[model samples]
Target: MAQKSAVAARAPKKKASSWQKRDWVAAYIFIAPVTLGLLVFYIWPFFQNIWFSFNDVNKFNMSTFVGLENYIKLFSDKEVWKAFGNSLKYVVITVPAGLFLSIFIAALMNAKIRGKSIYRTLYFLPSVTMSAAVAMVWKWIYNEQMGILNTAIKAAGGSGHAWLTSPSTALYCIMLVGLWMTVGYNMIILLAGMQGISVTYYEAAALDGAGPIQQFFKITIPMLTPTIFFVLITSIISGFQVFDTIYMMIGKTNPAYDDTQTVVMLFYRQAFDYGYKGYAAAISLFIFIVIMIVTVIQLIGQKKWVNYD
Candidate 1:
């Protein structure tokens, strides 16, 4: 009994199997490159941009810390205010418009219809196409002379005006292009969300004398609120940061440039064109602050409307 008790008192330490170690090694290997890229590219540059914002930076990257001088200049500058307002207008128009159109189209696409696959592919093609190419195509379409739109207007006995050269219409033209490009992607996202919903709820609603429109509002929309919220947040961010399409379609020399200039475009012009790197950095930081505040507001507001259940 004493010998057995002594033997039982000595316990062997357990070790992880080689396979477990191998699994951990594989996981780290898979994540290493992404981690390194984020650190070197995103994280580092973000901090550098913040540092540069407080200083007067030169082309050679030399800087003198000027505290809030750069920010002060930006706040006082009429051009900065104009560009910020333009960006805000862009967000206001595009975000809600894109969300509404996308939800509407997605609902239609989700319905029982022929050629649904083809319609989906056609809509998604714009998302895959390069934005610059898309912008160029739209630019020609909006050309003052010999453009398809102008040709159509002429055929209808209406005067053909330069759509992109007039301040009143140029921003709207840009917004339209953004809408065209964005609707498909958001539609697909919403369609996926709609598809994820159980059909039983819809069927039950149908059995309860609920019409299609009624089913859509009472069942589909409520269940799809989470997806809508996701798309809304992303759309707001993208809309606020709109630059490429505007830059490609409305060149710097365009008469309506000032009216259509987005915040990012203004930042580019200030940083690269005028060589005010510090001021540009400040502008970028301001944009970051705006986006952060808006996103936080959305997050807080989501509790009221974004239903996960």
Candidate 2:
């Protein structure tokens, strides 16, 4: 009996049946198109862009090997630094401001308020609107002469400065527009996260003599940290890549172009306008590196603050 049991234990497992093999084949077949599409469109282009960064690529799509030359130029380029500073400033200012506003609005929306649906729809309108259209509308609103803002200032017997043309205010104006366009969408996301928290927590807090504000800080905020971290990551990335609004609102000839130009705007100018594809590729790589670093740092930092439970 012991010998027979040993032989049974040593027996080879059965091979997968033909039906199982067919199922595996079918699964791969179903995924093949999407996989191929990613390889062709995203993965290939990413590696190609990296290769382009090391070469001197011209307007004619010709490339000549000039390893590290573009990267060296990138480091020494003043405009690149300026653009990077602007982008950094954008991220620094907008991410926190946007997060605060989003949280505040989300908290309000989460409350038992009348016309909540209507308020949400109204706030969300700008996020769904075309970015170019939003930029154009905001550009008009900040127009030096006949903008509603200026008109209101004039009515109040105060002079209106050129909002989008002034170096000091142009970036801030664009930031405001960005905040307006994004706040509603982010609020919606936060609201969903808020709603997912168990009612038992709030009830428990109430029984412990915790008021609304105390409960918010002690329980709600802690529980919502994961969602907040997600928002922070995405918002920082978006802020750093700000382009459409700056491009649409401030022209190449605009006085405040330098002040408002982000890394992406600089990349666009180099790649398309100036025909420095290689240098543009380098700029793009820099952007990718910066975003990657920021994301990695956030991922590490989240271990301390982001509450999964």
lDDT of 2 by residue, 1-309 (tens): 999999999999899999999999999999999999999999999999999999999999899999999999999999999999999998999999999999999999999999999999999999999999999998889999989999999999999999999999999999999999999889999999999999999999999999999999988898899899999999999998889888999998999999999999999999999999999999999999999999999998898564444
- Model 1, residue 296: C-alpha shift (Å): 1.0
- Tell me the tens digit of each residue's lDDT in model 1 across 137-169: 999999988789999999999999989999999
TM-scores of the models, in the order given:
0.93, 0.94
Query: CA shift at 54, candidate 1, in angstroms?
Result: 0.8
Clashing pairs in 2: none
The per-model lDDT (C-alpha) reads 0.93, 0.94
Candidate 1 wrong stretches, greater than 4 Å = 1-18, 306-309
Q: Quick one: RMSD of model 1?
A: 4.4
Task: Please give the TM-score that candidate 1 achieves against the real structure.
Answer: 0.93
**Any runs in candidate 2 off by more than 4 Å, and if so which?**
1-11, 306-309
Q: Lowest-lDDT window of 10 residues in candidate 2?
A: 300-309
